[model samples]
Target: MKQSEFIPLTLITGFLGSGKTTIIKNLLQREELSKTAVIINEFGEIGLDHHFIETSDEDLVELSTGCLCCVMRGDLQEAIARLLTKREGGWSFDRIILETTGMADPAPIIQSLVLDKISAPKVILDRVLVTVDSVTGLKSISEFEECSRQVAFADILLLTKTDLVESVEGSLEKELMHINNNAEIFKSDFGIIDLELVLGEYKRQTIAFTENEIDKHSHSHSHSHSDIMSVSLYFKKPIHAVALTLFLELLAEVLGSDLIRLKGFVYIKEAPETPAVVHGVQHIFHPIEWHQSWPYERKETQLVLIGRNISLPWVRAILETIEEEVEETTRQNEN
Candidate 1:
């Protein structure tokens, strides 16, 4: 399909009380979203009327019957079709944003767009933006599968209600990164954030890691929640391609579902000029993105893996073995 013909559709999802509506309410007030149509799907009896979005004949839509990911799946596709038809009929909009129910899983919604014959042509899946409430997120992730899946599938993770907390102390941030390393984390207050940050060029959305953030997490945190934990590894030297490849392959084979997500920037010895951006969900690894240059001052490898019932020491040992083999091979070649 031609890029010009495809309309970008972004998914705004989160667990219960993660502030999805609050963020969309603020976004609709922006000029950038003036041409955007919205589909709000809520579970149970909650309504969108509280958001105060100015409802016109065609601008807003709501679906309430269980969750869009399950019961309302057909309604979601129909809503997209209806909105597109409205655009063709003269009520114009450049894009669409679907705000999913707090209890919904977004994977099926995403699958519908990719598999559906009609909607697939008209709409393009743009981004998955998930909001996690900073105050109550830890308990939520530990207690809920829906919450973790929301985090795992997001392209960007926005932390809301940050004002309610004294300091995030990099604790929440670390947990989020482990859940989905591919997503760049951002903090929000009252769900207010720049529209440009949300709708801007996503390729340049790498989070700038500061020395303080690195220092704060110099030592890993102890987790009482054994089901979910994140292991962060850093390498000062560029990794050999063979070693990196072997490490990823072995993990994907052994860990599989236990490995929820893997995302990081790796400086490849083969391509020192350009760094490799890796993204993996479960066992499936997407094509590695090679950035033209490092996005931050720290030109080192940083990987955060979020998994359930995974051993950090075993993971570390595998990586150490790979690096040693690479070094040994390098010395042999030199001699």
Candidate 2:
């Protein structure tokens, strides 16, 4: 199906008290976003965030199962499916927004969207918007691994509570950039932002880096926070399709939950003209998306793996070995 045919789902996440609910509440009041269906996942027994949103009860579904990143992934999928089913039954909604508990990791929740056969076909991951408290954002990133991961996976970083602070500290912005250079940062006063920026056309950013560059980037940003890190791999040579599958399988088997997020475009030997877009969280991956043509001037494989304790050298070595073996096998078959 065409990308536009799928219902876009935006994920809102942040550290506790970062004002995710405030943002959702404000956005829902907008004329353009009034038709949005919101799914609020709260950690404890009582789910108060949904009540605060003020949306119609039918449009708001609260999940009190557990932390979305841990136990309630299935429930999240089911909720989306239910919402989509309602849409089919004359309930009108163009988009879906899932607000995860502040303490949630977000990776597993993402995995559910990427891997679920049911919801994956109907809904597309529009963007990951993470809210960070301007006053306490730096401390949260330093103290909590969950906060760090939220920042790392974010497509847009919303710095909330800016009015309370005299000035948004440069250190907080610097720390956020250090963790995730790709995310676009914006100052959100009382959770209000231009709707166009939040619900805009999705653009996939390419993260290409050599091993040396990854090492340098890591060393420079090592002092900021948690053990979570990122490694980028750029391969000029087109990899065999079989080799790409093997490479991802090996990574999933080896890294498991430690592999937080992996996304990039691969130049496949079989179809050199079209790039295969890969997105994965831990062991689960979205089906490879084949773009009509390369989105870059240069066509090459550029993959960024974000995780904890992942070795760049090991990942590269595994890919090279798998590619070589696959190439040799193909050559013999031809002979």
Candidate 3:
């Protein structure tokens, strides 16, 4: 199916009391997001986040069974499947926003979107927006592993509660950068920020990485804030498509959940003119999206993996070995 035909879904997540609901409530009020369907997954039996959101009943779905990530493979997939079915039945909505519980880990939720046979075909993951409390975000990241993971997996980091705090500490921003340098950070007052900045299509441009930056973060070391880290990889040569598949399969088999998120553009020898967009969570990967053309002048393979206890050198070595073996086999067949 064409990319435009798929519905874009954004994930809104944060630690408890980090203003995730506030951001959703505010976004729903905006005219640009009026036709958006919301799925609010709150912890415990009685859900309250959905009640706070004042959208049409038909557009709102509440999952109060438990944490979203825990039951995401089943309940979350069903919720999205139902929403897609409703849209087919004349429900008017162009996008979907899932607000996960504060305690939820985003990896499984992302996996559901990538792996679910039913919903994966219809919905595309647009972005992951994680709200961080300007006042308590630092503490949350330090204390709660879930909060740190949320920050690590974010595509856009929203620093909420800025209005309440005297001033957001540089330390908090630094800490966030330490966890995920690729995420775009924005300061929000009362959950108000330029919606276009967060929802813009231009933000989908392939991430660029420098050799030095990759070298700096390549080491496997422990951070005081959290063990979660990001590794940027840049490869000049085009990779065989078969080799890419082998690399991903090996990663899922070996790392599993420790591989939180992986996104990048691959330069495939089979389609060297257009870069292949790769996105994955845990063991599941979205079907490769082949762009019409390279977004930038320099066409190469660039990948950023976010997770815990992941070594950059090991990942790089794995890809190099797989591609080398695949190339050798191809040469043998030709000869």
Instruction: Residues 1-335, candidate 3: write the lDDT tens digits.
Output: 78767888999899999998988898888999888999999899988888888988999989998998886558887888888789878998998999999998988888777665666447877888999999999889999999999998888899999999898998788778767767888999978878875468845543534667545543422355777777777788899999999999998889878888888889999999988989877667788889888877888888888887788789889999999999999999999
1-335: candidate 2 lDDT, tens digit per residue:
78656888899999999999999999999999988999999989987888788878999889986888889988988899889888878999989999999999888788777666766447877899999999999889889988999988988899999999999998788677666656788998877987976677777776734457656666777576766777777888899999999999888888878887888899999999999999877777778889899887889988878777777778888988999999999999999
What's each prediction's TM-score?
0.70, 0.89, 0.90
Clashes of each: 0, 0, 0
The 0-to-1 C-alpha lDDT of every candidate, in the order given, reads 0.76, 0.85, 0.84
| Runs of candidate 1 exceeding 4 Å displacement | 1-6, 44-52, 61-65, 70-91, 106-127, 152-189, 203-220, 223-226, 235-249, 267-272, 297-301, 311-313, 316-335
Question: What is the C-alpha lDDT profile of model 1 across 51-143, one tens digit per residue?
Answer: 566646468888866688887778888888888777778988888888888888766787676555786446866778999999999889888
Q: Tell how far residue 183 is off in model 2, in angstroms.
A: 3.0
lDDT for 226 in candidate 3 is 76
lDDT of 2 at 244: 96
**Order of quality (lDDT):** 2, 3, 1
Pairs with steric clashes in candidate 1 = none
Runs in model 3 deviating more than 4 A are: 2-4, 84-89, 119-121, 206-209, 214-223
Off by over 4 Å in 2: 2-5, 119-121, 208-216
Query: How does residue 196 of candidate 3 score in lDDT?
Result: 76
Give the lowest summed-lDDT range of ten residues in model 1: 204-213
**Candidate 3: Cα lDDT at 131:** 92
Order the candidates by TM-score, highest first: 3, 2, 1
